[model samples]
Target: MSSSEVHLRSTIGGVSVEGQLHTLSVWFILALRLMMGLAFLQAGLSKLLGGEFNAAGYLANQPASNGSPLADLFVAMSEMPLFMEFVNVAVPWGQLCIGLGLLVGCLTRLAAFWGAFMMVLFYFGNWDVAHGYINGDFAYMLVFLSVAAFGAGRILGLDATIEQYDVGGQPLVERYPWTRYLLG
Candidate 1:
């Protein structure tokens, strides 16, 4: 272990994991970022490339159940003609943009934030109450949040390139602290 490592002993469902935080974090963050990136990319491509893709049908049929608190919101969204039109375009494009950003590890923090937002909408605003259980959306959302928190792009991503200073001795991130947050 390196001097930076913090030893940890933890268990999940009776399985024990003993390791150093600094050592594990690097691998975990990179894998998590890459996986989440691939997943978003696949989903975005499927939606964008799919024929006659529309959010209306999915939004319109939200089980409309009293058990589902978000059902009303879904209904309200569906009822708005302009909103539906916007959603039809926005969902696909937003997914595509977020996916591409994450995949290349460009604008990593922004990509992670948006990815988490979408998963929140999917897990809480659409799927949770009706489904009666947490699902992959929750897991994926956590992964995205982890990437942002760990600044995973610095591990092996374009963000690493953007992080270094230029000949002017000013990194782009010097112009925007937020870029440092993304590249970290």
Candidate 2:
């Protein structure tokens, strides 16, 4: 109830929720955004610079060995020459674009969405349920979701400036309200 705290209330799926956030929560949220940004940026940079990254071997072997339920689908995908070609290029480039978007906080929600998607694939590919259903990939997927939900891009990010840019004499988001889904 302090003046510095933020009171939040909302309802989703007929369920009501309420909470309060400490002023310092913003800094932690910012930290999560920056941490994921840096990690992904570095990963993408190394993958691209490392040269000729291929997913065929991983697709054919890793998922099966890890006992993923999607192992058959992964193997089928690897056997497709055209699909493999696309995967070889898409994985690295997608990572690079996603990383850059997040690092700069431009098209952040879009980037986070893709990041979470990639994590979903990874979670299945790396499939280790021996310790439980949760793993690093699953955790990273949640982190990406949290970042998007909290609109972390607005915290020291380009999305804030982009959203405020004048479009037809009105702020971009104000003019096109739908952009709220993509930006902060």
| The candidate that achieves the highest lDDT relative to the unseen native structure | 2
Candidate 1 at 112: error in angstroms? 0.5
Show where candidate 2 strays beyond 4 Å.
none
Q: How much does candidate 1 score in TM-score? A: 0.81
Clashes (backbone N, CA, C under 3 Å), per candidate, total: 0, 0
Candidate 1 pairs with clashing backbones: none
Estimate, for each residue in 88-123, the C-alpha lDDT of model 2 and write its tens digit. Answer: 888888888877777788888888898899999999
lDDT of 1 by residue, 73-177 (tens): 887888899999898887778888777777778878888988899888777555653454778878888888989877887787888888775736677777666
Give the number of the best model, judged by TM-score: 2
Q: Which residue pairs clash within candidate 2?
A: none
- Cα lDDT computed for each candidate against the true fold: 0.77, 0.89
